[model samples]
Target: MNRTLVRLLQAPSIILLLLWMIIPLSMTIYFSTIRYNLLYPERSGFIGLDNYRFFWTDPSFFPALTNTLVLVGSVLLITVVLGLAISILIDRPFKGRGIARVMLISPFFIMPTVSALVWKNMLMDPNNGLFAAFANALGMQPIEWLQDMPLFSIIIMVSWQWTPFAILIFMTSLQSQDKEQQEAATLDGAGFWSQFYNLTLPHLARPISIVILIQMIFHLAVFAEIFVTTSGGPGVQSTNLTYLIYIQSQQAFDVGVASAGGVFAIILANIVAIFLIRAVGKTLTV
Candidate 1:
């Protein structure tokens, strides 16, 4: 009787959760199979697979896909490498260590839109920005970051925000590391690099995998940074898959194509998750 009551209590929340996820996904799939356009609601009807075909054939599709991959990969590399180094550096006891950690990790808590705006207006602006002022002081011309290097600028902004997250994870993991092993290595004439490679790296394997998985999931859907900074332009130069989908749905009013693109994004995310899951499993076993 108690078990039955417990099951009954759990059923509502589980059903609600299912409905929350299923409803939007079902609607997207249904929309993808039809000719739904906000601009032409009167002409909407069944158009099986046409939306997918149109989205796939879009000239910007491949470029958007490429940008998505590059952004994810570049940010992952930067965050993981820099996060590990920063975490290690701050892990040791020192003056103002707590304050330093707080300052270093604060960037991750900033809103993405706010961070992007700050980078665009305060740092990357060609004139009256920090980079421009520094360049002028040095008698060198300021480069147009958003115009000539839009994608790279986005990468740098994302990396700056996410590296703090990686550092937080790595720092926590380092706390649980086997100090005895580290002490033994040091006593046996192991230098800093040797100890890091042999002892610290192995201990951080799981945290690294977790950081990669989580960051990849978020980075694939990056929109605000690109939208706020570059608006996915200089002719789609900084357009990732998420921004491309936005253009289709909001700008072009093509719900069908946007839904198709959403479906593609879901598939891509799932593929990445599956691959990372397998890699994480391997790391766990090792």
Candidate 2:
């Protein structure tokens, strides 16, 4: 009787969660199967896989796909590596460590749109931005970051914002580490690199996997940074899959193609998630 009552209590939330996810997914699948352009509703009809074919054939599709992969990969690499280094450096006791940690982690709290705008106008602006000012002081040319390297610029912004998340996770994990093992290593004359490789790295493996898994999921859908900073431009050079779908839906007014792109993105996300989950599981088992 108690178990039955508990299940009854849980049913509403479970059903609501299902409906929340299922409704939008069902609508997207239905839209992908038909020609339902808002601009041409009169021409709406069942089109089967025609929408998918159109989306796949779009000239920007491959470039958008490549950019998405590159952005996710680069951001993951940067965040995990830099986050680990920063966490380790700050893990030791120091003067003003609390203040340093707050400053380092503060970037993650900023909204992505605001972060992008700051990077665009305050940091990356060629003629009058900080980079240009630094270059002028150094007697060097200030390269146009967004115009010359839009995708890389986006990667930098995302890395700056997300590295703090990785730092938080790693620092927390490091706190739980066995200090006895470190003292033993030190007594045995193990140098910093040796101790890090033998003790710290192994201790951090699970946290590293977790950080990668979570970051990859969010990185795959990075749209606001690109939208706010470069607008996926210099001619689609910085456009990822999410931004590509936006271009189809908003710019071209092609609901069917955008829906098809959305479906494709869902599939890609699922595939990546499965692989990451398996990797994380292996780390946990080890």
Candidate 3:
């Protein structure tokens, strides 16, 4: 009776959630099948899979897809490695540990737009930015970041923002670790590297998988940073799948194409999610 009542109370929220997802998805699918254009709204008609074909064949499509993969992969690698290092460093008691942890995790709380802007104007400006000043002080030329290395700059900015998230997760996982096992390893003449390789790494497998799965989903839709810093330029160098869809919708006013791109993105995200979930599930079980 209690379980039944609890489920009854949850039904409204479940229904609302379904409707919330289903409505927009239904609309997008409908739009994807039609020749919908914001500028030529009167000429709208059913176009079948033409939008998908065009979007798939688009000149920018492959580059955007490649960029998306590179960004997500690079950011994940950097965050996981850096987060693990930072978490291990601060896992044990240290001077001002609380203050240091708070400072390190603070970046995760900053708004993406603000973070992008700060990186753009303050650090990667290439003219009067901090990096440029440091380069000049060292008698080295300041390279144009956004212009010369647009995608790398985006990767760096995003990695900075997300590393803190990984750190937080790893730190939490570390707290639940078995201290006695570590003590036993130490008494058995196990060195730091041996203990870390055998014990610490094994203990962190689940958290690392969790972080990768969550970050991968968000990384697929990285937009604001690209929009703010590079506008997917110079010449689509940093344009990912999300920004490519934005260009189709907002810049070209092609609603059908944009909706088709959205559907493609959704499919890609679902595929990644499935693979990651299964892999992580297996790791957790083992």
Global lDDT scores for all candidate models: 0.95, 0.94, 0.96
Clashes of each: 0, 0, 0
Better of 2 and 3 by lDDT: 3
Q: Which 10-residue window of candidate 1 scores lowest in summed lDDT?
A: 277-286
lDDT of 2 by residue, 1-286 (tens): 6999999999999999999999999999999999988888799889999999999988898999999999999999999999999999999889999999999999999999999999999999999899999998999999899999999999999999999999999999999999998999999999999999999999999889889988888999999999898889999899999999999999889988899999999998898799788876775753
Output the number of the lDDT-best candidate. 3
Full candidate order by lDDT, most accurate first: 3, 1, 2
Q: Against the true structure, candidate 2 has what lDDT?
A: 0.94
Give the least accurate 10-residue stretch of model 3, judged by summed lDDT. 277-286
As for candidate 2, its clashing pairs are none
How well does candidate 3 score on lDDT at residue 99? 100
Q: Clashes in model 3: which pairs?
A: none
Candidate 3 Cα deviation (angstroms), residue 142: 0.2
Q: Report the lDDT of model 3 for residue 173.
A: 97
Could you tell me how far off, in angstroms, the CA of residue 142 lies in candidate 1 after the best superposition? Answer: 0.4
TM-score of each: 0.94, 0.95, 0.94
TM-score of model 2 (CA atoms): 0.95
Q: After superposition, how far is residue 12 of candidate 3 from its true place, in Å?
A: 1.5
Better of 1 and 3 by TM-score: 1
lDDT digits (tens) for residues 1-286 of candidate 1:
6999999999999999999989999999999999989999898889999999999999999999999999999999999999999999998899999999999999999999999999999999999899999999999999899999999999999999999999999999999999888998899999999999989999998889889998999999999999899999899889999999999999999999999999999998998799787877775753
Ranking by TM-score: 2, 1, 3
